[model samples]
Target: MKHLRFLNKYFYKYKWWIIPGIFFVVISNFFGVIPAQVIGHAFNLITENIQIYRLFNGFERATVIYDIFSYSLFYFGMLVLILYLLRGLFLFFMRQTIILMSRHIEFDMKNEIYAHYQKLSLGFYRRNNTGDLMNRATEDVNRVRMYVGPAIMYTINTAVLFILVIYAMFSVNVTLALWCLLPLPVLVLIIYFVNTLINQKSEQIQEQLSKLSSFVQERFSGIRVIKSYVREDYTKEIFAAESQGYKDNAMGLVKVQALFYPTMLLLVGLSTILTVYIGGIQVIDGAITPGNIAEFIVYVNQLTFPVTMLGWVTTLIQRASASQKRINEFLQLKPDITSKNTESARLKGNIKFEHVNFTYPDTGIQALRDVSFEIGQGQFIAIIGRTGSGKSTLANLIMRMYDIDSGNITVDGNPLKGLNLNNYRNQIGFVPQEVFLFSDTIKNNIAFGLDQVTDEEVSTAAKNAAVYHNIVDFEHKFETMLGERGITLSGGQKQRVSIARALIKEPALLVFDDCLSAVDTRTEEEILRNLSKIMKDKTSILIAHRISTIKNADKIIVLDQGKIIEQGNHEQLLQQNGAYAEMYQNQLLEEENQSL
Candidate 1:
């Protein structure tokens, strides 16, 4: 129960529903209990051992209304009839109330979790799977709903049944009641031990289940690649191992639950046998009437059923506890990058990195070391470096993907730490190396968060990306549905669509991290020409390997081994005959040889 504190706010928000649910549960239990007691009275009357005139408490002496048989039959039948109808109606209400509360809370919690994921920085995603996080939002929340819903109903039903049954037994005869309760201590001890086992085993089962889900999702998403590489058997081996682990864990829980019902029956059987034997002696001695014994036995059986349900409820609660802990751990995690300030929209694209050093957390190798650079507003700059030379790391730093180990990054002459992170991010646009699109129409993907953008604006952005003509050629044009990750589109088309997405934002700072790598040289040249014209006044950072891509840039920074070895315009670096000069010469010679 203490593990459920993470849901405190959600519970408070929906107490209106929860309160009504509790009321319905209590009322429903009342209807449920009354029928059981009435049944006991009916049994005594069927044997002609108790008089119908004394139905309530045997307090009346005058029998004027009806004969014993007729009166007992009608009164007892009406009691059962009313109880059954009312019980069904109340149960219907209870089901509606609990479902409403559960679904409402589930909706709110899933929304909250999704909103929190949005608030988290990119570094959080680097260490987690998209599918697993999605499970927490979808499956785990529903599991929690089940726990809150039926757990509440059964908990109330269990408590109410125990109290009502105990009261009914004592009312019949105190000595018989005492004997009926004698097995309670042993039953409780067995239940406690069984519940402990169920809790422990159920937790392991849920963990293994999550692992199985993650394995299947990942493998299916990459199934084509596995087939291409001919790793089918290898993948199957891994999947089978994961699936078997889930089976073993689940079976362990089954074994624990299997023992629970039998132990419960044994306790109930012992109590029943003792009740019949002791009450038989009391009847023979004329200490108590046989009708009383019959009534007491029926109430005892009613009590045992709810107690049996606890075994299953115990299993669910324990499984729920395990799931809650995983979800709570995720919710409680602090992002790698966070801003403490409250100001909004303060960034102006003036970025400065001063003697910054960084190393990946898991691997101790420095990704960027003592790197220093600055860019003024509206300046178009290019970053050029060989593979593994930390070119991408600089682009990542602008978005604060990984924090620097030392020194500072300032935007618009103010430290980035003092600006609201979300506000700052909204002012920047990025086109990543890998192009990804959702399984939605092209129009929604382009307009994304710009609610007020017209179709004209989307068309203009797409035209600038050099993909508008290609899209218009499709049967659906801009309304065409793209497959997941834009699998339906060609490689160059996907890259251009991603570029169009970034262009649509019209951000003050636009960073292209290898955006033109997929297209041929001719297409790349045309796209860069268009981008250069449109972004003349906007601050832009282009990360590329082709010298032709960044030759006309206002500034070019060359990096090698996590340090900037050269910085200049294209002509200035060409004259130096240094690192940039060698790269330019090799590309020029390669093209010249191809033409020959």
Candidate 2:
């Protein structure tokens, strides 16, 4: 309930619809009660005139009495029919208002959640799974919507109808009303207890269903692996066991729900019997007429559903409250990384790292220590290292994905944290080792980040990345649609496409983190040759293991065990005979052997 208080602003924001819907609910219920009153009056008219009809019997204007009585009943029935029609119309308006408002709120909530997700830092995503995040946005929000829409609607409808019917009952015959309503409170109490049991069983069933779905999804996603391992029988048996569990849970729920309707009917039937018995006594004593008894029966019947719904309405609110609590957990989370400045700052890519130190927060592994370097504007700097030697960590720091634990990183003489985050990132073109492409056309993927791009620009970027021929070979050329994660292309093709995507931006700084690993040396050299023409005045950082890739870099930095080991040009490092020279010699020998 405390967490659900967050929705108060939304309720107030959409109060126009809610207020009108409430009005319509009351108006509809008002019309709804009139039908029972009219039905009672009709009964009275028929009961009173039956004797008069008999008095004129035996062919002495008896036919005239019959005609008058028949017309009177028809008129009263038509009034009841008109009253229900009017009730139905208002009910429709009520749904249009309140239900529609709930939908609007749902839409806004999903967008707000997704926008917040974008604002959260990478650490938050690492701390949570995708499924849980999606459930908070979709499943939980849906439950809250039920509270705002149907639960509220039924609650209001029941309360209003109860008040009107009870008032009418007391006004007619207090004694009969008292007897008729005796079973009602008992009915509510029993239903509440039984309904709680049913809800527990239902939640168990839902849990089993989720497990089944997860099992099936995993099996499908890893079908190839299972088949390769020849574990089809093993997985099949596991699935069968889960299915059995689901059936057992469902059966338990069905059994509990079986008690729901019968209990309601029994209690309602008791109330009805009490109404007739007590009203008969009143009639014999001349305290009330048979019409009064009929009216009491109608009122009891009218109240049967709303009284029964109290338990279900409470259940919905309880579920919604729980769900809203989960939603609030994410909404209240402030990101670890926040931009200190909003204004877009111009940068020329003079990056300096002074005694920077960082550790992976989630894993508690120190990835960089005492890393110091300076890249002047328009410098082609390369970083070479063994696997897990902090090469990518340096790139991540430069991208500002995470802040350092100590020391300062300044870009263009401005503190990295103090500069506009978006402005800084927008000017840099970064191609990660693991490439990801959207399930869209090649042209769109290449031109993804820019709002407006011409076909020529996309083609030029493709050519510069040495993947132009691949595009022209496709059936739809640039318009060819790819499968998930660009699975339709080979690894080298995907990497090249990602390069094209980054190059399309023509950013001030380009960071390629082992992006050309999949391509052959010839293609890699061709790509470097083409890029050199465009990178004449822009800063570039190349992180790679291959010496052939970075031998021509203006300056090279060698890292080992999370610390800088060497820094020099290729010739100077070869003269120094350090780790860089050893890697260069090994690669040169491998290339010579391949040629032989």
Top-lDDT structure, candidate number = 2
Distance from true location, Cα of 463 in model 1, Å: 0.7
The models' CA-based lDDT, in order, is 0.81, 0.87
Query: TM-score of every model?
Result: 0.93, 0.93
lDDT per residue (tens digit) for residues 341-387 in model 2: 98887679899999999999998999988989999999999999999
Q: Estimate candidate 2's alpha-carbon lDDT, on a 0 to 1 scale.
A: 0.87
> In model 1, which range of ten residues has the least summed lDDT?
56-65
Question: Compared with the true structure, what per-residue lDDT tens digits does model 1 show for residues 1-596?
Answer: 77777777777877887777777767776776677667766766665534444463444443442456677778888988888788788778877877777788888888888888987777677778776787778767777877877876787768866876787677767888888888889878887787778777767776776777788888887878999999999999998998899888888889888888888877777778878888889889997766666666767677778778887777777777777877887889777777787778645678899999988775577888899999988888999999988988898888877778899999988887777877777878888777788899888888775768899999999998889999999999999999877888999999998889888988888999988988888888888888888777788999999999999888999999999999999999999889999999999999999999
Q: Whole-model lDDT for model 1 versus the true structure?
A: 0.81
lDDT, candidate 1, at 288: 70
Where does model 2 exceed 4 Å of error? Answer: 187-258, 592-596
